[model samples]
Target chain A: MTAISGWGRYPINDTEMIHPRTVDAARRATVQANPGIARGNGRAYGDAAVGVRQTIEMAHLNRMRAFDPRTGQLTVEAGLLLTDLIATFLPRGFFPYVVPGTSFITVGGAIAADVHGKNHHCQGGFGQYVENILLVLPTGETIGASREEHPDLFRATIGGMGLTGTILEATIRLRPIETGWIRQRTFVADDLDTTIGALECGDSATYSVAWIDCLARGARLGRSLIFLGEHAALHHLGERHVANRFPLRKPSMSMPVDAPSFVLNRWTAAAFNELYFRAGARKAASSTLVPTHPYFFPLDALGNWNRMYGRRGFVEHQSVLPIKNAQTTLAEMLDRIAKRGESAFLAVLKKLGAGSGSLSFPMPGYTLALDFPIERGLFSVLDELDELVVAAGGRLYLAKDARQSRATFEAGYSDLSFFSEVRRTVDPAGKLKSRLAERLLI
Target chain B: MAAAEKAVLILGGTSDIGRATALAFAQSQWTVRLAGRSLADLQREADDISVRTGRQVTAHPFDVLDTDSFTVFVNALPDLPDVVISVVGLLGEQPRAETDLDHAKEILRTNYEGPALILRVFAEQFLGRGYGSIVGVSSVAGDRGRGSNYFYGSAKAGFSAFLSGLRNRLAINSSIQVMTVKPGFVRTKMAEHRKLPPLITATPAEVGEAILGGLNRRRDVIYVRSIWFFVMLIIRLMPERIFKRLKL
Candidate 1:
């Protein structure tokens, strides 16, 4: 009765039902509907989250089913969110293996994407920590898959994007922590060269990230700010663990509503970027835990911040070029964005290590991702960026791009045929489909 | 208990968040289908999701602008999904929306009319079947309409309120769960070329975890990052005259 979305931020149609609640109920709903798509907190900026006729809401399927403190294993229902997991485990001296940019994603979603984080250089991705999963097949049959048990299904499922089956629950390994804080170091780079030099230096970090501004032209083309961190040792927090343990706090007020346009533009963005670049006064020292939320992901603190981009919405252009062509590849990409006069403020550069996931996006390359508010000529800008990515033998991160040509996608991934071959084993009917699927021609 | 070989749907698909959510489900071995309007882009997203998630992910033609076939779309799926996540959002031109009636209507329709209509159907099926969960990506924007983006924020406010009500409604008689998730700024393809404030900006994965937390506790409302609660609270409590005068 309340309807589906809070704000009509997305273009949605009527004539459909969006279901929300428990797991058994999800099973029952599956039995009745001809087909349905599972929904999490609707944060995905593209159509992968849309439901045509039947949409199942997993926001309430959140439940920590089981946890073994000794081994630091957690069994959570399909809809459990990552933020809640950290709130529960961090004080317990444990955490999820890999995390993405925001905390609004679900456990089912994380497993579905096999998300990677800052530490991915050493830890691989999130899938490595997943012990097993309880799955529901298309025939409405339920099964359990893991590294040892349904090996093929397990591997395919990690990055399959929910086409293989529905995830009922996830069993994952949690990490051990000393204090609820981190020891962090910051490095300021005068150019891209210094940033690259710093990454090659050492791995004595639990986390490392570089912030680059794609807008800087000429002399300071790829100027950067690098930060590295590790968890504070056991003696750091002393006895604060018991007192701060659940950190019971009220949920933040959601975005009251969408904002007016005209708030975001090149001029506004430039001024902000200028201040941001100057604000990162660098230093290295032991830091406070400060609740893993903002530290791990600083952007999650504000709500509906994207509304500033006006009504046309925005898009992020993230491309990872092989390390072999790092300088040339990035230079070209930057040239394209700059020439188009579409430079975003928050451009990041990460020197990737070996990526081990089946369909992982980050490889042994330099990954640069930036957000650009949509405007006239933006599509063409993306088109040009895509071309640059292809020429460098690099690929666009499909997870981030809502507009990608089929040809570009095919060219981006050389082994496109191999994934389809594996998909046939799980879903031969091609029944499970999404808006993203139709575009890619898969 | 084993998870059923599932079919999942994301309403308001075509968003970076929605696509990522679909990818999340797909990688978990769930057969995922991303339904959206632009056939060209959606298909590639689906294929990419398929490769990324390793589930037999596909794309089905969908038009959120068309309100006539929500039921048909749901009925057409090969199988039912265990859950549904709606990351559908439209932060249309706030200036245009505030000044132009049509733009305001578009905002309301995209966030409210469309999602409500589709979700109502989903609710009926989920309730009748006695199962399912609805996770709606409400926003921190919905907390309190501020000076900058109140139009979009109000719609999200309605959405968040609706989700809260849905959660309360499903609490008693149904196994269905409703989660309202609020995320701050996400650095996505759509948000390229913008100056995002540092303290509250989040990446896709951080939001992914917050959504996970809401689901874990079956919480009615989830703030992706805990700090957002304080940020919004201070903003909300401020007097309107003073609030309007502050420079964001």
Candidate 2:
């Protein structure tokens, strides 16, 4: 089975897990299906890749159907991975402008989620970078999308969570890189305010992110470390320069099994955070040699870091808020979590840049992603967070959502109805659906 | 929904918890702006917000790293918002990170550097505006780290601490509201799990509600679900050596 979701751990009927090696095969598989999903590399980490009765493995259909060098635009079967694009284009000085956190994902999957990258603050997401897309609607009809063609469907398809239809191919723009390495720097913020202050105090760059220590208590509750980067100047390439044009040695490992849940309690995590915090002494460094794939998506290399959550597998609660709610909102949230005693041991924060896409996830405010083992009463806490987000003038990412309610879905993404209306006009039958769509009532 | 037309802005517009929180505001009475990097993705989100809340909504482009422009974005807005939700993160790999320093660097940078800078500007703006709520999504991970994603966890640990400091600073200035949201397990795309057990897991909506409730009560550092209070209390008591050997 491909790695689409932690949910796929559930036993699937033998009829599921359909591997389709070609476009025709995928079509045939769908034509004679036990109800399935069009799966890519399964990097989505959600149930969207899995089907109720069957799952169509679309990796075999990967192929670069076409390319346009001058525009740095290319068309490929949806199954293609960012890795594939990087390999095919590095020689041509082009790359997928907006990538997710990893290179293991597929072109179709990226489109489905309208994935963003560190440069999202600059380039937006895959949706904006996409010049066009080829999709197989729920009605089994193949179609294309662009600014001018099926505009609503195009918008809906991006970050649509693979609910609109099966993405067949996408024409996307590429980015230019030098030696495939980033010029990076790091800064330590004594507190959340300083960290927030530093990010805005710096110059514009291609990428930026932050890590915070939440357990310090009192004065250091939201203290953090910030890092910023820009594409290395092309002229800076030295004799030591090298290009890691391919995935070296298939960097892969799997979680042999789930560990115990209580393994990551506060005391253990607090020590780890303290020990880990003082280790990063390097502020600014320039090296000709950096693995582009690993640098862009190191988590993918771990294969199963989720096992760190133990047998129950964990969930990520990520969200964004406007500048107005920056301090107090965060304070209230941390206090609430502390008061309740949930150990979301890992929380990372980042500032967003300005860019727009139909189905994108980054924004101008701060964003936080935290991992937590599933437990009781968690939902109510999330519900409180939902209220705060509402009052604060923010929205959540649908592609990353799983347990959100229909009311919340409607509240956060009120504009989806227009997309939904258009979707209804396209496939009136509601053939394209997933657990997310069901739960959110989208 | 009303002539006052309160609006909520989610800076980390792509996070599940952020989205769910936004939905909660929509349900009440507020125009929702699904602010983020991709306007298209946020457009659908805006649409959803309006439908749920029966309020007008729109998607706007924003850049937290560019605080100079943040005010411009706000001034450019048709109306200023009453609340803000910030949920962001980056979990870098710990193993490869030890060998590939860049991986480790990205993990720390993504979690701390970016968010810290922008929130400063947000606070100043809030002071000038004299009325607003800021919900920063921090994690219990920052409370500490395990062998896994330690760099990422430490960054969050730092953020969690920072939020507390910010709250204390804002307390004297009653005009501003700060809420730190720390949730344990939330079922979302980032985690990708089904049947998250009852003891620790939560949905984005649940976290959303808790955050709002905390905001209304003017509380600080809200746990998405209350059970995490007990769970962490126990986890914090475990001995270090024993905790290290723990396979969890």
Candidate 3:
């Protein structure tokens, strides 16, 4: 058995990690391992991809099956990382329709999580672009699923946390871009109300997100810099970027190991947030031409950035509130964190469109994400936050969730029964299992 | 697929190092041909690389131990590649290898005879062409045989010596280059069972980068991570009395 953990590096488990390079090998592994979960790149922040008994590491199975340049549709193995896809296709004028904050995740992980991006307000989640998926059932039977066929299974599989089956491959439609640049504009919001207003006003933008100061209180509560971006066409580029139409980013620095536990304290987080907010505020005056990589995935430049949270690791609390009372709920959420003085160094807010899939996290609402270093009393505070979120008809993102009560999950997702039904249909004996599945009683 | 001006062939193409090196070359716009015992695995790897780089990548079946088929394989290629890399190796269980003649022979032949024989054919072809590069992925274990893995170590030692001899002979032809890469403790399947120190362990991509850099600079011998060179040097310098007393 090997010790493994997701990106958070917390709650590590001892499991046999099997790396099968071919579909046949993977099917054979599933037959041998009675209950296991398929893990892709291990980018999920929690135990969603971890199987205590056996974890099928899909890294070796990555391959491209087919592609149609004319339609920008590509069929790729589930293990293919979004990072590789972007590097390969951005230069060729095509890009994934929905890319999460980090491109390090795998296609399978994205589909399983139904991940949303900065463009959620316009493009929805990644699952919307997937035309079809090939899934290997626990019985080792490979079946094709799409909206037109096996619609229930298809809906259950997306954002199902790998409970239904092992994703073999998927055919996804890619968006075409003229250049690898974003015409970015920033809006500075002074308080919680203004931040919500700015986000609502920027809904027309192709991509939009906000960096809020969770520590800010009173007059500065929820102070944020809203960044709105649109894919820059060739004509929009300046002379300097014209020659190099598509440029892939290389991480300039890396955190080789976890920082000392004392490195990330309340004071340090506040100070960093202060400096970050001020720096972003300075750029609020005029629009800028930024590389798409930095605009979309700024933190990816710092390789292994999760290590910055120190040895105890960190937990991301991402909750989406219904559009009706989202602003008030967000205000209360920020106030709670600010009052505790355990404000996160990285807090993001985005507007989500109507969601698809039975267990998809997004809705026609606002989602707030905050990363807090794991510490004593942290769980109690998060539980309190969850209460407030649930009261406002909100739910937490499963991709980023490390801990949440089963009741909280059910209360948030009303379609849980439908998802469970389809999951049982595909894996009757519950042959496919994960830590997340066990914790959520899915 | 656009026809690349240059082409490179990779032996043992399904191996971690071979796959990584193939990706590095493909990204640099070289048409890639991957040869291994399993055409299925090679075809999958080739397709992946081709998609990632939009370069033509073809898969061919070539058994390293089947010396008689080497000539036929070369003759069957549509075009001769400008560069060739051999990454064949076997890390059979050291304890079993020590006690079993068949196991020991398999390791020796895989690490030494098979790679040497196949590379020899490619070397002769390069010589005839008067311009080609040959890369042999050897191991740091070759520097000094340890009690824990002497069987694989000795085979690598012989392979490294063979590469040195080939480099010496190829020097007469200025255009032909021969490079030997010693990757110490790579995080590939070969070392997956061991607890490799993160500080010293190199990823397959690192080894790939080192090989590409060495090939570009025409370096005759290279350690994937420079620290490995000094580490191996210290090991090679140890007195036999002390080395025998200490277990590696």
* Candidate of highest TM-score: 3
Alpha-carbon deviation at A398 in model 3, angstroms: 1.3
Judged by DockQ, which candidate is best? 3
B236, model 2: CA deviation in Å?
66
Candidate whose lDDT is highest? 3
- My TM-score estimates for the predictions, one after another, are 0.61, 0.59, 0.88
lDDT of 2 by residue, A265-299 (tens): 76677777777567643443323334566667767
| Residue A199 shift from truth in candidate 1, angstroms | 2.6
List pairs with backbone clashes in candidate 3.
none
In order of lDDT, best first, we have 3, 1, 2
RMSD of each: 18.0, 30.1, 3.7
Report, to 2 decimal places, the DockQ of model 1: 0.02
A312-389: candidate 1 lDDT, tens digit per residue: 666777777887888887877776776667747568877666544455566777788888766778788788878888
- After superposing candidate 2, which stretches have Cα over 4 Å from the reference? A1-15, A28-36, A242-250, A281-289, A353-359, B1-248
| Number of the candidate with higher TM-score, 1 or 2 | 1
Task: Mark the 10 consecutive residues where model 1 chain B has the least summed lDDT.
Answer: B46-55
Docking class of 3: medium
Q: Give the per-residue Cα lDDT of candidate 1 at B150.
A: 81
Share of reference contacts found in each model: 0.00, 0.00, 0.56
Which tens-of-lDDT digit does each residue in A1-442 have in candidate 3?
Answer: 9888888887788888899878887777776666789999888888899985889988877788777889999999999999888987888899999999988889999999999999998888999999999998888889899999899999998888888888989999999899999999988999988999999999898999999989999999999999999999999988998977887887558999889988888899989988988888898958888987887788889998889998888889999999998989999989999999885778999999977889999999999999988999999999999999999999999988889999899999989989988987888888888888878888
The true-structure Cα RMSD of candidate 3 reads 3.7
Query: Cα lDDT of model 1 overall?
Result: 0.69
